[model samples]
Target: MTTNRTVQTAADAALWLAVHRGWHVLPLNYGTKRPLGGCVGCRADNKPDHTPQTCPCLARGDGALCHAVWAATTDPEVIRRWAQRWHTSVWAVHLGVSGLLAVDLDTRPDPPPHQPLNGLPWPADEPPPADGLDTYATLAALSGGTVGTDTFTTDTPSGGLHLLYEAEALRWKGSHGKPRPGDDTVRTGLGWQIDIKAYGGYVVLPGSTSKAGLYRRSSTTTTPRPLDPWLADALTRTGHDRTAAPDARPAAPVPVLDAQTGPARYAASALRSACAELAEMEPDTGRNRKLFRSTTRLAGMALAGWIDRTTVETALAEAARHAGLPAAEIRYVLASGFGRPLAVPDIRSAA
Candidate 1:
C-alpha cells in the first residue's frame, strides 16, 4: 500500500515489491514473461530432467536465479545482484510465495457464431460475454456479488485487467506458467478469457514493461483486498480449492422418484447412489475415474431407455463438480464414458 517510493526501473520495482509489500520477486526476461534461461549446468540440454528440488543450484544460494519462479526471493541483496546480472530484466512476483491470487481478465474476440465460448452454458436471459471482463462481471452477477473496485488492480499491455486478492489461507493445485496446447487463450473451467494465477504461478509486477506495453496499477488502492466471499465460492465451485475434502453431508439431496416404478425406479436409484458417491469423493483421489464409471453406468441406462441421457449428464456433472473436478475435465470424462459401448444390463431384466 506504500506509494511514497517511485519505481523507475525493473530493479526498483522488484525492490519496492519486496521491501514495501513483502512479495517474493524474480527476474523475468526483458520484454517477455519468461524467466532467464538456466545457468550452463542447469540448462535442459545439460540435465533434461533437472528440477529445482533436485538441482544443486538452489541449495548453493549463489543468487543464480535459476528454475524460474522457484528462485523468487524477497532478499534485497539477492534482488540487487539479479539487477546487476540481468540489468534489463523485468520483475515477476511469485504468487504462491506472496500469498496472492490474481484473476487475469484478458481481452479477445468473441467466439464465432453459434459455438458457446469455452463451451460454457450462458444464462438463458443474458447474451454471452464478449471478453474476460464481461465474463467476470457475469460471474459476479450470477453469484450475487459485485465486481470489486477497491482491490489492487492492474492494466496489462493488451488492455486486460488483473485483480489481485489476498489468498494466504487457501491453496490450489496447478500453475500459470506455460499455456497448455489448445488452452493458450482462455483458462479452462474458470471462464472464456479469465485465467487464475495462484500456487506455482507468477504475475508480472506493475511498473514492469513488456513487449506490448507497461503493466501499471489501475486501482486507487495499492493494496490487494481480501478475497471476496462470492469470488471464493466461485473458485471453490470451479474446483480451485485443492484443500476441499469430503464432508459428512452429501453435496445435494437425492431427488424422490415418486412417480417412477419398475425399471425407471431402478435407473433413478442407481443415478442417486452414483451421485451420492461422487459428492463424497476426496480431491485428486481418482475423481475422474469415478465420474467416468458413473457416467458410463448412467449412460448405459440412458441407452437402454430406462433413463434420459441429459438427466444422467446433468446430475453426474453436478456431482463431479462438487467432488472438485474442473468443468472441462468433467466434460472430457463424460464424453469418454458415453463413447464406450453400452455395458449395463437392461433395467427391466435386473428388476
Candidate 2:
C-alpha cells in the first residue's frame, strides 16, 4: 500500500506537468476549471516548464513575468513572493488585455472588435477607429496613386473623403494598392477590397461631412481620367449623347427584407454572428486573414439591410452609439455598396 501511494504521487506530479504544457490534463479540483491566465510573451499560463530565466519578461521582463511566476508555482510562499516583486505599469498590460474582457462583461456591451488594419481607402481594410479620420487620411494617401481618389461628397457634419469612380473603373484601382488590406495591415495577404456595386459609391470620413471629398478610380496601366466620361462630357460637350446608360443595379442578396423590422433584425443578428465568428477564425494571437472576407460579408449584410431607410437609419444610430462613431457620413457605406435587401435572417425569422 505504501509503494502504491508513492507511485500515485509520482503520477499526479507528472499529470500536473502535462497539464501545464497544454497536454489536456484532467481536472483535479472536481468543478474547478484550468488556469486561463498566463504570461503574454511566453504563454506561461499554457506553458508550465518555463523558468524565471526562460520567462520572456526576465530579460527585461516585468509584471507579466511576475504574474506568470505566481501562476506557475503551486507553493503559497513562492506565489506571494513573485506577486510582491515585478509589479509596475507593465501590470497594466495584463489588466488592459483582461480589462477589455472585463469591461465587455460588466458593460453588457459588445465593443467593436479590434480592427487590425491601417484605415486608408474607399473600402476600408478595417473599420475606422474612434478619432480615426486623421489616421485614415494618412493611410488613404498610401494608396493615392493606386486605383482611386479619396474624396468626400456627402454634406453631413463630419468631414472625410470618399473614393469615387464609374462602376467599371473600381476594378482596376482595388488591385493596384500598396501595403493594402490583407497584405500590410492584417498580414494574411489573401485578398484586397473589391467594389462589386455601383451607385453613390461614397466613402465617408469620420468627423465632418463638410470636409468630405470624392475620389475616382484610376490605374497606372492607363492614364487616369479626371472623371467618368458621362460626367466629363456633360461638362465639356455641347450635344447630349445617350450612349452610356445609367448604371444598372447589381444582383441583390436573396430573399431581401422589404420591411424595416425585417432588416433591423437581420443587421443586429449579422453583426453579432460576425463578431463571434471572427473570434473563432483568428488565433488568440490575431494572425489570420480570413477575417477580412468574413467581416466584409457582415458589412455586406448590414448594407443590404440598410436599403430600408428606416431600418438602416435606426440601426446606424445604434451601431454608431455603441461603437462611439460620429454621426457624420455614417451611411455612406451603404451608398458605396450594391443596395440589396438581406433575405437570409428575415426568412429564418419567419420560420
Candidate 3:
C-alpha cells in the first residue's frame, strides 16, 4: 500500500501545484536540503577547481542537475518530464527569489526526555518551538484579523509546520546577503526558531520525502495575506547578536554611485540596478541559478569595463547580504556563474 506514495508522485504533485501558482519549482536531494548533484559523468568532467557555473555539463544533453536552480520553470509539461526522470528527487520552492515568504514554525523546541529536540538546528538559548503558536497568535492580533488562522500552511517532514504568505518584497535585513552555513538565523516575527525563508532562500516543498519523513501539506488556507504593516515592522527588528558585527570582513556597502561621470561610476549604477532587481526577486525554486544569472550579468558588466571592480564587489556584497543565503554558497554560486575563477581583489579598476 505504501508504494502508492512513491517519492516521484509526491514530487510531481508539488511541481504541478507550484506551477499552477506561477511559482518556479526545482528538485532537491532526498533527505537533504541541497539539490541532487549532477550524474557521475558530469562530476568526472569537472576539473579540480571547476564550479557549477563553468561546468559544461549544464550545457550538455545529460546535464540534468548540473544547473539545478536555473532549471526551474512554470511549464507544466517540462515539470512532468523532470518528475518522471528524477523519481527519488524531493522538491523545493525558492522563497523571496520571487518575493514569496515561508514562516517556518517548528514543533515546540521541547525535546523529549533523553530524546533530542526534533532535528531543527535552532540556537541553544532560543525558546521551545511550541512557542511559535503564541508568536503567530501575537502576529495575527497585531494584523487585526483572522487571516493568519486561515493562511496557507504545510506540514514539514519533522512534524513542524510552514505558514505561507506573500510579501511586497523581501523584508528581513538579516544575512547581509551573505547567510552562512548551519545558519538558520534568517529573521521573521519574534519567536524562537521562527524562520523566514525569503529573498534568495528556499524550503523543501510539500509532497517530498526526507530523513524525517514525508513533507505533507495540511488543509491549506488559499488566500495569501499581504504583509501587515505592524508584522512587517516587527520582523525587521533583530536582536543584538543577529545584527552585523563591526569587522574587516566583506560588509554590505553603499556602491559608489555618487559620481555622475567615469566608467567605474557608470558601471556602479548598472550593477546597483542589477543588485536591486536581484534583491526584489521573490524567493522561489531555481533561485540559485537566478542568483547565478544575476550575479553573472554583474560580473560580465565589470569585465566589460562598465563598472569598477570595487563597485561590483560592493554591489555583490550588498546583494548577498540581502539574499541571506550562506556566504560559502555564494562563493560557489559566483564561481559557477562566472564560468571562470573570480577573485574580488584581483579585478582591475577601469581607466
Candidate 4:
C-alpha cells in the first residue's frame, strides 16, 4: 500500500484510501468537513421531503453522491468522477464500511471544563487529566496497556489525535460524549473529549486539508494494528459494542413532565416537537442551524424551570445523532445553545 504521506490532492487521497487501504471514501466540501451540496434532484429545496434513506438517487445507485456518507464507495471510477464534479480539498473514510474504528482525542482548553473521568470515580493516585490525551493515557494505565501510538495515527488540524485501529469481527456503535438522560454531568465517551468512531461515523483521511490546517500522518506506521484487547474492553464498557440488532437506533429520552398544566405541559410538547424535527433533518441541510434553534429554545425553558437541562441535552443529542450530524458538531451546537441567551416564557401568565 502506498503511504499517505506521498498523496497530495484530495482525489489522490481518496483513491489511495479506497484502493490501498480498502476503505470506502467520500468527498467533503473544499477546505471544510461538511459534505458537498446534493445533486439537483436531491437538493433540500428541490425535494424537502426526501431523506438519505428514502432518496431515489441512492436507491438507484446511479453514483450521484447525494447523501455524503451514504454515497461513500470503494469504486475508483466513482471517486474520480466525484473529484471531477466537486472541488474537494478534504475527504472522509467511512469507518463502518471499512471495518475500522478510531479513537478521536480532541484538544481542549486549558483547565478543561469537564473532567476526564466523567462521572466515574477517578484513581486517587493520578492527578486530574488536562485533556483527552491525558484521559486516554489514564485509561490505558488502568487497563494495563500502553497507548497505541505506534499504530496508524493522524494529527488533526487542531492539536489532537486520531488513532486508527482495525475492528476485526466486532460491530461497534459510535458515541460522542456520554449524554444520557437524567445525567447532568458533562461526560464524554470513555473520558472527557474522547470520542469513539465506528459504525455510522467517519474520520478524515490523512492528507486532507480543512480550514483550520492540514490533517497529516503523525506516525510512521502505514497500517492500522488490530485493536488492543484492553481498548476493546474499554469500548464495550463504554457502550460501543453492538449487542442487539445492528440497525437499532438509541431510544430518545422522554422529556420530563413534572406537571401536566401551564408552561410545564407547553415545554414538554415543545421539546417533543423540537426533537422530532431534529431527527427528521436531512444531511447537508440546515441541521446545525436547526439544532442551534431547538437547543436555544430548550435551554431557555430549562433555565425557566419548566424542563430539565439534562433531559433537553440528551434528547437533542440523540435526535441530532439520528439526523447524521457528526459528534463534534453536535457538541458544539449544544454548547452554543446553552451559552446563548434567549427569552423565556412568562410562567406567571401561563399559570
Candidate 5:
C-alpha cells in the first residue's frame, strides 16, 4: 500500500517543479481528480467543492482550497504546505490559468467496457471510418499542423494521449468557448476527440499520478509551440456538428427496493435524484461537460423504465438553461447523454 508520506513527497516535488517552470499547480487528492478541502466547517457535508472560506483566521493563514481551481497558485510555500497537509496528493495544473492548454486525444480503438465514451458522433451501427479514429493523424489533417515538433507530450496510462502547448493568453477565451459532452471546450471549427482544456478547467499535469496510473512524459521534446489555430478550429467545429450518439445503453441494474413500493419505483426515484443533481450545476463553469457524464447514466434509468424520455428532456433542458447553456448547446448535450450507456449506481443498491 502507498503511504501518505511517500506520496506527499513525490507530489511536493512535482508541483514545485512545475511552478518553477511557470505553470500553476493545484494539488489534488491522490487517486481522485479533485483538490483538497478547506476545514470541515466550510465544506459541504456531502460533496466536495472548491470555494474560498469566509473565516478570517483560515483565510489569512492559508487561502481555503474549498474551491479547488480558485486555489491554483505558483506560490511555492502555499503549495508546499498543501502537499504536507494532504500527503497523498497529485498535481493537476489549472489549464488556461497560467498560459497553458492541453490537447487530450482518445487513441483507444474501443473504449473499455466499463468506461464507455458517450455521445459518439456516428450512429451506433455505423462506427467511424477506420481512419477517423486516428487521433494524431486526424489532428494533423484538420489542424494543418504536425505533432512532430519539439513539444511536451504525456503518454496517459489509459492508452489516451495528452500534448501540452503554449497558449498566447492565460486562459481560453470565455466569450468564444462552449462546453461539449466530453468535457471538451470547442470553438466553431474544432474536431472530434480533440479536447481543449482552457479556462475554468483542469487536467492532470504530465508528471502526475492517479488511480488510473502514472502519467509519463513519453516524448523527449520539452519546448512547446503555440497551439495550431487549425487544430483549435477543428476542436470547435467538430464538437458542434456531430449528431450521432453512442449505442452503449444497457439494462439498468435492478433496484433493490421494498417489494410493497416496487423496485422499479425506487429506480425512478434514483433517476430523479440524478436529474436534480445535474440540473443544479453551474453551467457557465464546466456544466455541459459534467452534464454529459451524468445524463449518460440517467438515460440508462429511463430506458430501464424508471423515467420517461420527455420527463428527462424537460428536466434537463430547464437545468441546462439555468446553468447558462444556450438552446443549441442544450440540445446537443442532451442528445449526447442519451446516446451514452448508463454508468450510474443502482438505486436499490444504494439501500
Candidate 6:
C-alpha cells in the first residue's frame, strides 16, 4: 500500500538538490533517523507555562515544508543572486579530476622529471554537462578511451589499487582562474589536461614499483620519454598508446549530499589545500600555476587507485588542518564561486 515512507523518498531527493545543486531552500532537521525529520531528537516543553521548541523540520516531515521550487529554479546565475541577497560567502571553486594509468614500461627506466601521464585531446568548445552527476559520467566515458582500464595503489592499508574509469570535471573560472591549455601550443580552452607531478608510483606486478612520467604523440614537438617500462609496454600493448580522445556525454543532474558529505568532498578539500600551497605558486607567473588542478589530479589518482572518498576526505582534511584552515570553507567556495579570493579562517588560531 502507498504509505508515508513513499512520500519520504521524494522529500529526500528534494533535500539532496538543495544541498548539492544550489537549490534555494532550507532543510529543517526533525527526525532522529538517518534521514532528517522535524528536528530529530529535539524536545520542547510546550506546557501551560512554556512555549514549544521550534522544529528544525517544521514543515518538512509534518507537512510539505520541503518544496520542489528549490530544485526547479536552482542554477548558477540564480545561486549567485541568492548569495548576494543572502550575503552568502564562499572560499574557492575547484574543477577537474585526475587519475593514474599504466605507463609504457619501455619509457619508465628514465621518465621525464615532469610530464603529463598521457595526452588528452578534447575539443575546446565542449560545454560542461548540466549537473555534477552527468559531468562525471560524461567525462568518464570520454576519458575511459584515454585513461583506459587500470588498477591504482594508494597509502591506504589495503595496498590494493582501485579500479578506475573516469572522474569529475569542474570549473570555477569565474571565481578561480582557468588552466590555460597548451600555452605555447595551438590548443587553448581545451578539455583533457594533466598536472606533470601528480603522478604516484606506476603499476607493475604484485610487488614491483615504478616512477611516473608523461607521454606525447610522435607528431607533437615534445620528446617521447620513458617513465616506467611496464607502463610504457602496457601502452604499446593497448592501441593508440600515447593519446586519449574525449568521449562527450552530457553531464546528468544527479543530486548528492553537500560537499562536506558528498562523493567529491575529498576533491573539494584538496583543491583548497592546493590553492593555498605555498610552493605551488610560480614566482614568475605570479598566479598561473595549476596547483589546484594537480591536486584534483591527485584525488583522481586516489580514485584510480580505488581509494574511497572517505579515506581521501580524511587525509585531505588532516592535511588542510595541518596547513591551518577550516575544512568546510574550501568546499563552500568550489561549489559556489571559486577563485573569488576569500578570507578563510586560520586553523592555527583555533588551537
Instruction: Using lDDT, give the best candidate's number.
Output: 4
**Ranking by lDDT, best first?**
4, 1, 5, 3, 2, 6
**lDDT of each residue in 12-122, candidate 1, tens digit only:** 878887998888888887655787767777765456667777778877776776787888888899888887666654578888878899888888774612222222346
Report the CA-based lDDT of candidate 1 relative to the real structure. Answer: 0.73
Q: Between candidates 2 and 3, which one is better according to TM-score? A: 3
Candidate 5 steric clashes = 19
What tens-digit string does per-residue lDDT give for candidate 4 at 1-351?
223342347678789879998988887775457666667767654556777678888787656778777778888888887776765678888888788999999876745433355435557777877778987888888888999688889999889999999995339888765344433334446876788888878888888877777888899986899999998888766667887434454444444556666777778888889888888778878999999998898899888888788888877886887787877788889999999847787767865
Comparing 1 and 4 on lDDT, the stronger one = 4
Candidate 5: deviation at residue 27, Å? Answer: 1.3
10 residues in a row with least lDDT, candidate 3:
111-120
lDDT of 3 by residue, 54-166 (tens): 66655543425655564455566666776777666477776654456777765555422211111113335544334445445544454464434466677876666777777
lDDT of each: 0.73, 0.29, 0.56, 0.77, 0.58, 0.28
Instruction: Candidate 4: list runs displaced more than 4 Å.
Output: 1-8, 43-55, 59-62, 113-115, 168-170, 178-188, 244-351
Model 6: per-residue Cα lDDT over 109-198, one tens digit each: 212111112223233455533322222233345444333222222211122121221212211110111122322121111111311111
lDDT of 2: 0.29
The best candidate in terms of TM-score: 1
In candidate 6 the C-alpha lDDT for residue 42 amounts to: 37
In model 6, where is the ten-residue run with the lowest total lDDT? 169-178
Q: Poorest 10 consecutive residues of model 1 by lDDT?
A: 176-185
Candidate 3: lDDT of 29?
A: 69
All predictions: root-mean-square deviation over Cα? 7.6, 26.6, 18.2, 12.8, 16.6, 26.4
Candidates 3 and 5: which is better by lDDT? 5
| Deviation in Å, model 1, residue 229 alpha carbon | 1.5
Runs of candidate 2 with Cα error greater than 4 angstroms are 1-260, 280-289, 307-350
